[model samples]
Target: MTNNNNISLLTAILFFSILIPLFLSSPPSSSTVSTKTLVLPLKIQKPPIGFLSTSKASNSSNNKLSFRHNVTLTVSLTVGSPPQSVTMVLDTGSELSWLHCKKSPTLNSIYTPLSSSSYTSIPCSSPVCRTRTRDLPIPASCDSRKLCHVSVSYADASSLVGNLAYETFRIGSLTRPGTIFGCMDSGFSSNSDEDAKTTGLIGMNRGSLSFVTQMGFSKFSYCISGQDSSGVLLFGDEKFSWLGPLNYTPFVKISRPLPYFDRVAYSVQLEGIKVAGKLLPIPRSSFVPDHTGAGQTMVDSGTQFTFLLGPVYSALKTEFVRQTRGLATVFEDANFVFQGAMDLCYRVPPNRKGFSDFPAVSLVFTGAEMSVSGDRLLYRVQGMTGKGGDWVYCFTFGNSDLLGIEAFVIGHHHQQNVWMEFDLAKSRVGFAEVRCDLVSQRLGALGLNT
Candidate 1:
């Protein structure tokens, strides 16, 4: 979905879903026998270009989102004693799950402070509040009255601010006690439609207080099919016999002490990229961790478009242009020149039809491999440069200039139509190609015996 002449500035903020293990304290040993795996169906959506969004159809009051929002997925589950189902974004890039605090008495399914007997506040001086770990290094501080205060900011200045507290969270048949979360009383809305849609964010990173950590698990995995179908996100004990011939690669740990690395993300080694079976000229070192200790490749559920450091993007674009010699050069605006964080969009002429011959793009991971077909490599659009314009497909991959510094990001666009598993026990990342919508025979569910 490309933007019209007046491109929308709505950008998908980095939700940094990192699942690092605990080093500050001895993490509770994951109970293998009794650790019940929970299965939650995720509703995924591809909201326009250069943005992110998704919510239940019933959440229409204030959840007006732009036509061009980013690719975001939401999971609906209840919380508190009576179990009020609330929809929150399933972000691997975030640390703690949170909810928008209710101000009015009649707000739909929001968290009411006066209600819920399981609610417990984390004091500013409490041990949980003072712990400085990755993703949550700035551990929540206390306000003047000694209330545990938490504030989170997203990529486009959108934010969530409130008190830190714990409540009973019930998703599917699984229930968790003392689930850590922020009572979001205030925050920024990218647009009007997003005001009420800002129900909350569910964090599943590696922080001690993250959903996975609180649940006492070392591993989890999600198979994303795409926008049309609901996918499975399983926590604990995922045996991928359904995805035949699983290729596993070491899930390297980049130390957090370095200021350059976010430390909250799961990092992987990228050897290089190939287009049409030909390797790009980009040096392998460019994809690896640089001297500053940054630029390692990562896979994230929150990011919509795959981003490459400047060096990789330049080389890839050059090779791509060289391969597709006859394709239309997608021009934007009156200048018809490419600049900014995103460019390289071309439209087919009136007489001509769909993309004729596009080359395939592949990522060469350390040990694993992902073959990206040409269709997934570009964004097909009907109108963009002008009204009722010819259909075009924008270059879905982007470079460092648009993202500020050269940053390596493997967004969900590349993750589609594949089976991916993040195994924390062996510290490895595994992948296989398969149909995501097919119902898989379960190895485990929350209450059912495997």
Candidate 2:
């Protein structure tokens, strides 16, 4: 839907509904298996233009879409009997799909169980409640009604208290009955502005109860376009020549339980970092997770900026400052930090229209590399300017230490314009840089025929 100013976002949920039935209805021999693509068009809203105000900036880093708020990758899902379409965030960092069940004055939509003919809450005696949720950060418990219930809290301080239930889910032509999900009865969000507009979240993490795992999909891919446009989310192993040959990296295999890291996270081995074509002096061992499992690098679509450990961040910031000494004047004011985390601020000259003089930054993984240059290297923190009315641009990377999270994170800002394929069967992640707008256009034109 477009705003009154003519800025458009995704208006519909496009799907190739034939996929689920083809894979689930019958057992296919190796020779008979179909590798057809299942598509879901993704919607993302752009941050407003310069000099905008947001009340939810400090709630969490995920809310900070590179200093812009309310940016999320969303898709529509039809849930309950006599299904109703609900907008959901497609999150790779969370495990359970949930819908807001309680009606609130501020909420746009809620799934009322009394209205659904097929809604059935799981009893506390059910093993599905106990076994399936054992590994989750927030495990299931029995409510006063002897129903399976859970209370989940996000880093943003938003929470959902819900009961586990089984209900029918409709995805285009494919209707799956008795699907398990969370029917939340109560919740509170620090960012009620965006929460009021959407229903809930769809978890796509590596955990057992995630949407991809529940659907039995061996692989999935998504292309996040520039903020103004729509993108495509795909499931199954259909390869496109236009995607080109992707660089592959193996996900870290944890043999035992981790002390600090989320065991089910999509983590990869990070080799090193390079600034201005020169590799940093940090040691490779520093990137490896210690006995406490603290340093593994994870790819999280929910977060907005990349975060590194304190030592690694110091090395990077030092090298970056060294290379861009004369390009722009550093904002040396003690209070220049943004959100109390991003401290590398610079005052660009009034005539400086671009950041071409700044050095490029690269994150080198085992068999892949993510390079950031031009506008990607620095984000303009609008609504706030430096002395002499010069615009301020801060480095996009942040310190993971600020969050007390010991692991490194690669967030959404770096994933733009790239096709990321998470192959669960092979336990590998494939990435290739491409114009996501082209993929969105091609998929939009093909529609559900594919």
Candidate 3:
């Protein structure tokens, strides 16, 4: 993630805001009209009392840990009358999938289709259309059927606006029956030259009206293999038992839901730590429940590092330096480190104490607990920035970013099973197992250096 790459990623996001309007004027072919109605198997449920609260559980014995792996689905969006496939980042943090459209007012570097037959736009009045034209700057005369409008905000102070449409969207072996996404008419120009390569983005978070949800499919999962194998998003019953064991966590709804979807919330416990094979002074009281937006854990396969908030970030870095001082060397990279220059390498001395002192990071959930090996937690990704000379383990977006809702982001790539089960009626979240190897393999193939 060089400065050039970061700018490119940002540019791609900004471009969608401008290019969504051009394709709205065209009508869909009669053959493209979908006659099939989609019905999902999983039912949306409510949460139980104190489901997302930080208070102690009444039945502490009921707390259990489950495991599951995070999955990635590649989304391709084609723009214009003759649609063309565009490569984009499928992000759960985002809410819509949009491409560069023909009517874009501003242009830089992007793919536009030469033929009009490839893409289709859903009318504004369509029952599924969740956006309003007034929200966007679109003129009232712009036939809603021709243009699709949508709004999306990110933790990093970035926002997107574009038109929505139904186009051919493919993920692994599954092709959505009739996919609805966004197409940016313009806005994605970049100050840096590298920003132009991206085509669009795909949103895969819970509570999103993504292609998976729009097609009326429930219980969608995928595996993000490490940098070697292309990640796959499983749809319907396309099962893969090799995904290790499946684990589930409850999806906490936001007190105030966003325009297009609900927010996912959860509690995390800092528990304790093991340094040099000895119990450290870390306190259980140090484990406070984070309900602010800044505490959002990005379950993103697209991201390599597991970013933590300010307090956790500081404590982890300090302990790593204290315990591994002999083998570690401070670098100008603004983060603590062992002795390696590249690939987040940390040198471990050949001694019993060295091995015993290895850092063990744990995450305590309501009824379950998970740990990150010292090596993995200390692993670093290229081009990540840190604050006050610390490695970029996680970032703090502050409470404003969350808009008073909590964000537990699962990176598009990571080696863990992340299950999100929402029981609306009981308001209680469940825990599942997370498989690491599967997540590593999936993310590795996508060029993410996790």
What residue runs in model 2 are displaced by over 4 Å at the alpha carbon? 1-35, 50-69, 349-352, 445-449
TM-score for each candidate, following the candidate numbering: 0.81, 0.85, 0.56
Candidate structures ordered by lDDT, highest first = 2, 1, 3
Query: In candidate 1, what are the lDDT values of residues 1-450, reduced to their tens digit?
Result: 100001111123333322221222222222232367667776675434523223311123342222223446667778876776688777765566788876633234477756777777666666556664333534466788697777665444455578777777777666676677778787664443433553676776555566776767688777777545566677677554566887877765764455445454556788889999998888767877766556766666666677677778888888887887776654444323222344566665656543436888888988877877745777654223333555445677776455354346677667776777777668777778776677332433222333
Tens digit of per-residue lDDT, candidate 3, span 203-231: 54343354444444554444433333333
| Winner of 2 and 3 under lDDT | 2
lDDT, candidate 3, equals 0.37
Q: Please give the lDDT score at residue 248 for candidate 1.
A: 77
What's model 2's lDDT at 216? 60
What's the lDDT for all of these models? 0.60, 0.68, 0.37
Cα error, candidate 3, residue 273 (Å): 7.2
Candidate topping TM-score = 2
